[model samples]
Target: MIKDIIANTTNIKLTVIIRRALQGVASNNNPYLTLILQDNTGIINARLWDVSATDIEALVAGQVVTISANSLLYNNELQLKINDYQVLSGKEAEKHYQNLVISAPINVEKEWKDLLKTVEDFDDAILKKVVLHLLKQNEKDFTTRPAAVRMHHNVRSGLLWHTATMLKTAKEIVKVYHDREINQDLLYAGVIMHDFGKIWELSSQLITNFTLQGNMQGHIVLGSEQIGLACRTLKINEQEPIILLLQHLVLASHGKYEFGSPVLPKVLEAEILHQLDNLDAKITIIDDALKPLNSGMATNRLLALEGRIFYKHEGEKKKK
Candidate 1:
């Protein structure tokens, strides 16, 4: 199994999906390929040195292939040195494809149902209509798609998991700040809509990739545009302050311009949604990084967190 083949494993043959493949030239000017391989268990980096042009051409992302590789530690993380690899075909490829996609840890169906219930229970009629309309329109992909190609919550049904968790967090936060002039309805709606563009941004394949629109427009722009379309479809008043506020929530979700947000969070609700979105995404990254480590060990540098290393304490207790 992919999980069992770790550092020190040598000459192991495995059937895997090519999550990513990039062609490069070595220091000696020899052609090579850097690959991110995946299976149902997890993903790992692999290098193919001195590869032929034909090999480079054939190794496409999302293709199934069998490889013989030696597992070793590089930069404190498990990496594979590919001895040889071949693209699989026919029934062989199909069989491996069925078993190679990883999914969200939570029950997707349950979370989806709970998400719908939350939307339906919203006290604000306009927010309720806007959110429900979008959810219903993209129901299948919304529930099944990964939140990203390869970032926080990038598993099957991860969009649902990420959105649901944010909604739950927003609910608790609004209650604590009940005295503050917070709009609970907007908070809930923003949380649901913040990453809605990812449904169009990413492919729903086993090894997710950016769609053409995703590459060109990204999630923020696409999300904002989506909100605009939904508003127009519902015949929502253009003069309504809520319409602009909702658009701001999606546009400024990244919190700042350098981080890809076209605008910064201007309203209190948008700001809170931005912070909550960052918090949930970061926590998920930390959790995923620590899962493969034993107690008292430090994780390999996390690429998602700017190469920060996290330690797992033996008696560490989760925050309540």
Candidate 2:
């Protein structure tokens, strides 16, 4: 696994998928291949020195290869010094595909089943129908796609893990505000639908890049449009109360206009959805940052957290 690469590990043999491949030139105009390799656990960077343009273009993303390398740790970055590598293809690549794909640790089937059931149990009939219809329509991608290209939940099945966790958090929050008459159905539907368009926004599991439509319109716009499409398909008016509210939640869930929300959240449920969504994504960012650090060591600045660094303590408290 890429995660197991460390300073003292002198030499290793591994099979991984090429997540990215690019050619760069040095001052002398020597061509080198810059490669981002990925496996189930994590990813690592590597350099293929003295490579031709042909080598760089031929090694496209999503190609599986086995490498023989000596670990080189330089300036706090670990890179593979490739002594040799062989591209695996046909049946051989298929054999390693399952192990190389990064995935959320959650049980995919159970989480997916429960997520569907949550929608099915919604007391609001209109909300229930729209959410279930859209979710089932995109079940294949929603169940397996990554939530992002590189942020929190950037692994296969990460979309489910992030959404499921947010759903659970929203459920508990609804109970806490029991007397407030908060719309649990709307909040829950918002959580699920907020990022559902990512199924089309991001590339397939092997290489998680933004599609042209994603780069142009983004998930928020795409999701809101998806809701509008669903309403039309079900013969529900786009201006119907529930349809409008759901679309609004999807639109304003990013919270601020600066963050790409065209309008601020006017509804309480939309605001709550924004908070919970940000909370989950930020929590995952922190957890992922702390992973490779030792006690008393601080992480490098994280752009995801506005360039703040985090420290890992010696030990964590046990759950009772």
Candidate 3:
């Protein structure tokens, strides 16, 4: 698998799904295909040099292909130089497609049931009703969409997995501060709604892209707008304090103006949600980066992490 690859690894044949494929021009005016390849393990950037127009037409994101590549360390990142590739079709495509796509590691049905139970148990009746209403309105998409196109929790049903894990983490935090009078119910609702807009922002569950609205307004704004819709649907006044709080949580979840959400978190729950959101997302990002490195090896600078390199401390066999 990709995680075991090192600088000396060469001439490997890998069956990988193309997560992204872009054609670009080299310095010498030659055209090349820059492909982001993914498997169940992790993702890597690869280059198919000197490609013709037919090659560009033949490749696309989500297409499964078996390729012969020479692995090389470029700028501290392990990347592939594809010498050749063949697209998989029919039974072969079907077989690899099921096993290759990155997915949530939890049982979907169980998570859904548990999530609903937690929401149902909320002490704040109005908050519970609004949250349940929104979830019911978008259950199918919420349960199916990836949290992002190519970042944290960018896998099948990742939104649910991410939200559930964050909720679990928040629940523990609430317990820790049980004596502090923090409104645990508000925290729970805020956590779930923070990334709620991704379901609508992302174009599809498969072969995902940003919707026009998603690109224009972004998920934070898109999600905040939903609070208004939910209020109208639930016959709650938009001016209610809880409604205002939920909207703030949704809009300010990003935590910074440059990050997209211009409004900084004002309420305690919004602040808590922002912190947990970053913790969860960074944890996932680091996990994904470390998965493709050998123990004691360091990854290339990760753009998402502000060009920081991370090291893997233990290997699979060592852990065993």
Per TM-score, the best of the predicted structures is 2
Q: Model 1: residues >4 Å from true position, as ranges?
A: 303-306, 317-320
For residues 243-266, write the lDDT of model 3, one tens digit per residue.
Answer: 788889989898999888879998
CA shift of 21, model 2, Å: 2.1
Which lDDT value does model 3 have at 263? 98
Q: Give a tens-digit lDDT track for model 1, residues 1-320.
A: 67887689889998899989998899999999999998989888899999887988889898899999999988667889999888998787998787898888888788888888988988888888988999999999998898987778888889989999998899898889889989888888888889999988997767788999999999888988887888899998755788788889999889989999999999999999999999999999999888766688888878868988999998877656
RMSD, one per candidate, in order: 2.3, 2.0, 2.5
Please list all clashing residue pairs in model 2, or write none if there are none.
none
Pairs with backbone N, CA or C atoms under 3 Å apart (clashes), candidate 1: none
Residue 34 accuracy (lDDT) in model 3: 92
lDDT of 2 at 174: 90
Off by over 4 Å in 3: 1-11, 89-96, 314-320
How many backbone collisions does model 2 have?
0
lDDT of 2 by residue, 32-121 (tens): 888999888888888888887667766789899998887876655678877778888999999999988988989999999999999999
| lDDT, model 3 | 0.86
